[model samples]
Structure formats: C-alpha cells, structure tokens
Target: MTRRVLRTLLPAAALVWTAAVGPAAAAVPLPIDAPLCGPAELERLDGLQADLDAKAAAGEAGRAQYWYVDPRACRLSVAVLRGAEDAHTEGFVGAALAASALPAPTSLTEVDEPVDRRIARVPAPAQRGARAAGTLHGGSAIYSGTSGLVYECTSGLNNYRPGTTTTAGHCADAATTWYDARGNRIGAVTDWRYPGTDWAVITPVAGWSLPNDVLGSTVPVARFGKASLGEAVCGRGATSGTRCGSVTAVNVTVNYPDGLVKGLVRSSQSGGEGDSGGPVYDGGTGLGLISGGASSGSPTFFQPLTF
Candidate 1:
C-alpha cells in the first residue's frame, strides 16, 4: 500500500508545467488588435478601437489613463484618472466590442496617479554593499545621486561590449558619476534615453567591468526581446532581490508624471522604491527594466527592449 501511494505521488509531483519564455517568447509579440480584456478578443479589437487607443496615448491629461489586457482576470482594463472620466472613452470601447461580436470582458480602472518608476527614486533604508564593488554584475546595487533622493538601484543587462552595462536612462540623468555597492567608482554614463524610451548605456572606467551574470544567479542574459502573455518572468532589484510573476500585458503605455511613456510591460510582481532599472528576465533571456507601478493593485511595470 505504501509502495502504491509513493508511485502515485511521484508521478503527480514530477508532472511539471513549463513554458520556454525565451527568444521564442519574444517572437510572439502581443497581437496588434488584441481585445481589451484577455486573449478572447485577438484580432477583433481593430478599426473601432482606434479612438480608444488614441485617448490612451493622450498622456497625463487624457481622459483614459492606460489600457491593457489582464490575463489573470481574463479581461481588458482601461484605467482613467479618478476624477477624469468621459463618456466617449467608454462608448468607443463598447462600440468596438459590439462590432467585433465578441463577448467583451472589459472594465475601466480608476487610478490616483501614474507611477514614475525611474531610478531617481524616493529614499529607503540603505542596503549594505552599495558603497562600491569594482566588478558590477546585473541586479547588483548601484548608487547614483539624484536631485532630491539619495537612491540606489539594480543594474540592468550588460551589453556585449567589453566594459559597458545598461540601467534606467533616468538613472544616468540623476547623477554625473555612478558608484557600486562597495563605494568603488564604477564609471560614466555614455548615452541616455528617457521619457520616450527608458534606458542608459554606461561605460565603466578602467579597473571596472560589467559582467554578464546577475548578482544572485548563475545564469546571464543570452538574448532579449518583448515579453509574451502568460510567460513566467522574474525581476531583480536592490530592494526586492528577485520577484517572479507572469507577464500579464505588453505594448502598454504608462502616463508617468514626467511624461507619457509608451511601450511598457505589466506583471503581477511587486518592487519597492529603490527597484528602478532592475532586470526582468525569462530563464536566461532578458525581458525589461522596472519602470514604475500604481499606488494600488501593486503591479510592477517594466520597459521592454526595442529590437
């Protein structure tokens, strides 16, 4: 009887479910005409949905705040600012779904404000090791002073170049010089792209090299691209370490206080104040960097690499 129970349990335990959220995952970009709710409306939200998207792209003052499909809730959600609701946004969405003849599991969310998740963040209890580390790896703590916040952040992917790595473009904007957890001088910012697309390329000085490995893991990025729906992903931050969640939406536009940022990804994982520019990955493949999140719902938004 014991042997029989063990045999049954062993097979059940061994039956694991997995998806290769790597290069293949990137290949499958979110459909252009995806429904507002979930996968049920693929290729159907087109034509009539144009006005709705336009409103979402309107940015800070626009009636519609954001639009994305929630796979967990299996619906599309359009978030409007708490006090900024207009009938046109709702009517347009309804008309599009009606024309598509699909059961629209769609709803609108009201958020207090957009989450500006740049590396120039609010201060938190300082974590050790951010003083300096001559050898910086992905997800390692980085110290770069911003105007008001004495913030530390996690490093992003290291480029194929000899001594270069990437972080939040806003991070480069925060300070002229960057330091590592051990207080070692890391290097200088080479180029920065923020607001529109958030990324920065850093060229470390002599004696410092940006390694390919993540700080806490043996695996490093072999490739990078857009994240796919339902793909399992993880984000690494100086504050959060590593948090795993499913890629819930892509091709998302976030209306940040700085400006309207287009082309972001949303996940269920959570990060803290100093988590900006952290690495988001699937297996060994890089996915994105932490952008910001809402005050509620606790979603961690990331900036996907354009390739």
Candidate 2:
C-alpha cells in the first residue's frame, strides 16, 4: 500500500502568472463537454466488472488488472499488465464490452510496470518538531499498530456517531489498533474494504471526539456526495498538507501491483506519500478519500465516499 501527504504549495512561476492574467482566468481549467455518468450507468459498470472478475478467477480469460468507466469518453476502459494480453484476454474484453451496451474503450494502454506502493517507507518531514500541528483533526496524522510495524496515514472524516471516523482501508488492519501522531491511543479498525473499494471506519476510544472540520482550514464537512466532472476539489493529508485541484473523471478503476480498486475519482491534484486515506472535499461536502497518486504533476485517484 502507498500513503500520501496532501499539501498545496504554489510555485513562484504560478504566482507570477496569476498576477499577470488576473484571478478570473487563473482558476483551474474545467473539462470541455465531459460526459457525466448517471447512477444507472455506474451500476451497470459494476455488474460488468463482476463478470470480468469471475472470468479471470475461473481461468477462462486473462486477468483484467483494472477496469473503469471514463465519463469523458462515454466508454469503459480496461488495463492489462504488459505481456499478459492474449487471445483469451481479447475475447474477454470483447464479451464484456458487448454485454455492457456501452461504447468501447477509447484506448487500450498496456501497463508496462507494476504500480509501486513503496511510498509507505517515506517519512513525512512535518511529522517531527511540530507537535502543535499534530492534533487529532481531519487530515491529521494517523497510524495503526505501534512502532516498527506501524502503518501511517491521514484521518479522513468524522462520522456522525461521535467517536467514529473513516480513512483508507489499506492504511489499517482490522486486528490492529490506531493512534494519533502524538502517540495517543485513538481507536481501532472496526470495518474495512480493500482490493475493491478502499475505505475503513475507525471507532475512537473513550473521551476522544471527532472534529467536523479539516485541520489547518475552515472547510466544514457535513455530508458526502458524488463528484461531478469539472468540479473543483481539495484534499488534506498529513504528508502533503492540503492541495486543491479539479475533477478530471469519476468511476475510475486503477490496477495496482497489489490488486485492483474501482469507483475512484480522478483529479488533477498531486499527492505524495502519507496522503492516503485523507479527505477529498469540495467546499463543505465530503467527496472521497485519497487512495494514491504518481510522484508529481500527475493525477491522483480517490475512493469515492458515496460507495
């Protein structure tokens, strides 16, 4: 698994451009005429994904490492690991595409390499000496287990049930207890979904209260909702801090070396290690949890909260 830190730092060049072009045009660019998928299409896509998974598990076809609906192209796309595609895979893709009654994939890019999850080894620089910034707030530092085998992550949201909260499932094991950055015992994993949907719920120990707002910001989160294309979104993580970006696509499935995850929200925002399980929100509404992202200047994917 990988962790990311969600901080937004503006470059000097960007500041200069913003001043020269005026704030109006400096806004994040929206996608042009991007097709939006309705709830029904999303359901159908899920059904088709199940069939593909079954076929792969049965050894009847090559494994489709990842599959997702690209609303911008109004089609579904699947990614196969390089050197894994064969006649069986092609046939499986054909049948799945035909069964969905949707447009074919716009492209069939082969994944040349495995998706690396080594970000867990990279420590967050902000984790040290800034005890004041390490309070238990949304986007604050979180971890499961004690030292040595600990898995670090970011707090996502505060559930309505007082001490209950959520984060990326990959960050917490059901058998392990969780703690805050200050070494205070916080909670334990109550439930989790991974290798499919990446989400987990943590129930805090006695006397701990969940906050309604993310740390270091006034953005309030009351409810969860689906992200629309072109929507402006922001995320907060312990490693990256907080960064704002635009929604590029939704209902995306990514193929990671560990396994596959579906129904993700893709954004132009960048994230680094320790940002996983952080909150992805727009204004006051919660949208999703940061799953993973590339090194830099690349899109990051989030597990949608509505799922």
Candidate 3:
C-alpha cells in the first residue's frame, strides 16, 4: 500500500502547469480580411498560424492569442505560445511575411498580454529582482520597487483592502526568486498580480527580508494626482533605466502577448523586458505601472495606479 501511494503521488506532483491569466477582454478574433499581403500573403499567414497551433498544442509554445495589423505603422504583432521558450515563434515570423507583399518584418517584439481573469490564480508574495544604476542606500539593489532607480510615484493601497496597505505597482514580470544585486536567485515568486491593476503585494517567503528603507531605491510607489493626456511623466525600470516622457494618450487598448490591457495610459517613454511593472509617474506623483509598449517604439502603455 505504501509503494502504491508513493507512485501515485509522484506522478501527480510531477505535473507542470504553465499558468497565465485569461484575456483582459473577450477574444477579438483576427479577421481573415484583416489585410496583410495582397492576394499572395494568405498562405504564409495561414502556414505560420498552423505551425504555431502545432507547436502550442505540443507544449512547445503558447497560443499566439492576440495580433494587431496597423497599416499606419506597418506593424504586425502576433502573440506567441506560452513559456519563454515560445519566443522562438518569432523566429518564424519571416515565414509569415514570405507570403505577404509587405516587406519582411524588420523586427519582432514580444510583450506580455496578461488578462484580468487570471489575476486571482497568481501566486502571493511573488518574488522578483532588480539591478540599480549604481550603489546607494549604503548598498545598491534594494528588493522592493522603491530603491536605486528613480521612477514616477503614485498613491494606492497594496491589495485594495480599504486602508490596509498602500503599495506601488512597479516590479513587472513577477518572478519566483529572491534576487541580489548581482542577479543571484534567493527565493521564488509566491504570488503576483498580472492583469487587473499593476499593484501587487509581495510577502517574504523562504526567509527573505523586505527592505526597510525607501530612499534612493527603485521600488515604485504612489505619489498623488490624476494624470491627464499630454501630461509629462517620468519612469524608471530594471530595463531601459530611467527616462522621462509625456503621456501620449489614455484609454488606449494595448495587446500584450499575455492578454489585452484596456483603459491604459499610453506614454512616449521607451521600456523593454524587465521594465514591466515599473512606475509611470507624473513628476514625483505616481500615475501607473508599465504594462507594455506599442509594437513600434511609438508609445508605452501602463496600468493606471488606481486603488
């Protein structure tokens, strides 16, 4: 009986669930008539999707759930299947263009498109890491979203429990590791908020300590004020470091590979991977958290810091 119980439990424990949030909005299907290449490009797009479906089904990739075709920008974004390895799907992007009259895509950008529905399943006390511009606060690389790098600040509660705890929405791409200044893994991400709002509260699991200081760190926080269109803002992230720009637009629909993000503020500040969940601030006031940027470098979108 003991051997049988062990055998059953081992297989059940071995299962790996590639978790993700659902689409922020309903699935907006890609129309066949969306217009890519003239008549010659259909096969290429179809073949690419076919290959993607195959790969996704086999767990080699996640579904390319969202895509956008903007003739004005001449840009096409396709969401890849799950797992970071699915990034390889972009490598085949050339094939998609082969069937199109459009010129071969000069570049392919990958962004997370987390949906609102999946937020509840996210772990708590999700772990993450950051590399500061330099040493500060008696040392660089503070753990929370508020040290090292300078960023826009906002005001809000951590998990929206009335007046429980106010927290920042910085630190995107929630991980499961307690990382050090030099990028060493110390813990794992226990919980995280992906799609709903950028705000997520992280608890210390596996014996990690939350930084006690708030000065001169990259940990994001809320300041004050409601941002408007064309408002100038500053942002700091683990990637692209610190940069200042203006809010280009608001209530924009951004399609991330993870899912759709609606009612987002679009900004001109440039951000890249590891920059997700960075603070979007109106001067010293916090505006939102970096969700994703436009496929082109035209603008960035962030989840407004609303508690």
Candidate 4:
C-alpha cells in the first residue's frame, strides 16, 4: 500500500503534530529574481514535474534524468546521464508534457551530475558510552537488540502521536524494541516501511514520552513540509549531532547497496553511522529522514516525508 493510503487508514489523531516558523539555523534564502512562473503557470509546471517523476519511477529511459519543481529558478530542474543529453530526449519530454494541456515549466534546468550512483545506509558509529537522558530528543543515542545489531543509532522526529516517535524503517528491522542512550526503554515498533520508502513510527515504552524537538537546537518540529531546492536543511543523528547542508535535488531515485529506493532528497550534508532514521528538517518544518550516504563524509541522502 502507498504511504498516503496507509496514513489515511491511521487514526486522524495519529498524524497530529505542530510545526511553524520553528528554527532557521541552517536555512538559506533564495536568490533575488522575479519568479519564473506566475500562480497559474506554476500549477502547470508542477503538474508536468509530477508527470516527469512518475515516468522516471516507471523506468522510462531518457525521461529528463529526474526532476523536481525548482521554485528558485521557476523551472523544472532536470539532469541526465553524462551521455544522454540530446535534443531527442528534450523533445520527447516536451511531447509527453503536451498532453498536460499546459505550457511547459519556465525552463528545464539541467544539472551537471551523474545518472547512475551508489549509496549505503548511514552505518552506525562505534559504540559510545551510553549516557542516559531524562527525555529523548532527535539525535539522542538509541539502540535496538532485535536484529543482532551491535551498533546504536540516533532517534528521529517524534510526537507523531502523543506517545510515539519515528526513525528509518531499516532501524525497525534491527529493533523490535528501542532503548535510549542510558539504556532506558524507549518503545517498540508500531509500523514501518522500507525500500520504496524508508521510515517507521515507534510508540514510546513505559516511563518515556516522545516530544517534538531536537537535541542541541532550538528548532522544534512544529510542522512537516518539503525542503525546497537550494534550501539548507539540518539533520541530527546520534553520531553526527546536528549536520546541515543545502538540498541539491528532490524526488531522486537512488541505488542503495541493499536495494533501489525512489523519491529521496539528496543533500551535501554528512551523516555518520548510528544516525539512521534521523530527522532532516528545514527550520521548523520536517523535511525528510536520513536514509544513507555515498561514504562516511560523502553527500547525505534522505527520504522525504511525503515520499
């Protein structure tokens, strides 16, 4: 089932959380320029962008690499394999978009990047002295003994429900029950999804509560939203603390070591092991969940909340 469908089946209260203008520690404003498209035009551009993403997900070769609505350029940001850029490809895209009955995006921005790539799950860091905390926050040390994992990972955005929290769904595979740094019982997995998407929700075990905040940062997750192109977003993993970087692309398909995952957000931020399922947010709005990286210090990738 789709994430949206699963969400709708959940109790309305299960999805409750508050996020507003929370924190801007890493947020960067877009450059000054007239918008590429007006309201009506933006609608068409967005619709076309969605169509392009759908095609890419369906394995349509030469479908403009991958795409997302670049609000800053007021265009559809696209990229192609080093050798696949050609008029025929662009023309093919244009022909497909014509059926939308809307003008094309203000422009199609081609980024200089490779089409094929590899990434691995942000591996958990070496064991650290477990220091227990009275309350857990994003970036707090957490571990699960469910899957023979000897490493621990960081916690993620919390308060999905009054008594629940979240993390990478892969973490759930390693943990049926979660524990805090101090070895406190945090909770157990309520639901999780991976591969196509990477995320999980955990209900706090007894004697604990999941709040909507991150450790070492004033920003509290008061809302959930997208991290726009060129926007700076911060992610907190147990080992990396709070790492921040600009988003390079969204709606990206990544070939992870274990499987191919689609619709991930890619950024320049670095994430360490033990940070799986950590939260990536733009100011007060939650953006995505850390999925993996190319290396220990390579560009970081995440699962957009909506994806």
**Top candidate by TM-score:** 2
Better of 3 and 4 by lDDT: 4
Rank order by TM-score, top first?
Answer: 2, 1, 4, 3
Write model 3 residue lDDT over 1-307, tens digit each, in one string: 0100011112212212111122122222335345445433434444444544444444333333333333322334343323445444544443343423333221133344332211111112233453332222111122322233322222222222322222223342433333344433333333445443455433323433333222334553434456675588766554455667887445443434444444566667765544454555654455665666533333566667554
TM-score, every prediction: 0.69, 0.70, 0.41, 0.61
Tens-place lDDT digits, model 1, residues 1-307:
0100011112212211111211111112236444444443543443233445555445323545556544443334465555654575455444433333324334445556556664545543344555334667888778774233566766888873446877776676676576675556678888878776677777887766666777677787887767988788888888778888888777676666666666789888877766778889988888888877755425778888872
- Point out where model 2 deviates above 4 Å: 1-31, 34-50, 55-65, 80-106, 110-119, 122-135, 160-162, 295-297
- Candidate 2: lDDT over CA atoms? 0.65
Q: What is the lDDT of residue 201 in candidate 1?
A: 75
Q: lDDT of all predictions, in order shown?
A: 0.63, 0.65, 0.40, 0.61
| Residues 197-284, model 2: lDDT tens digits | 7888888777776778887678678877889878999998778888889997677766555656767878888777778888889988
By lDDT: ranked, best first: 2, 1, 4, 3
Local accuracy of candidate 4 as per-residue lDDT tens digits, 130-156: 444357787677777423435566677
Those runs of model 3 whose alpha carbons end farther than 4 Å from true positions after fitting are 1-174, 182-191, 204-222, 295-297
lDDT of 1 at 54: 57
How many pairs collide in each candidate, listed in order?
Answer: 13, 17, 47, 12
Alpha-carbon runs more than 4 Å astray in model 1? 1-64, 69-76, 83-106, 111-114, 118-133, 146-149, 160-162
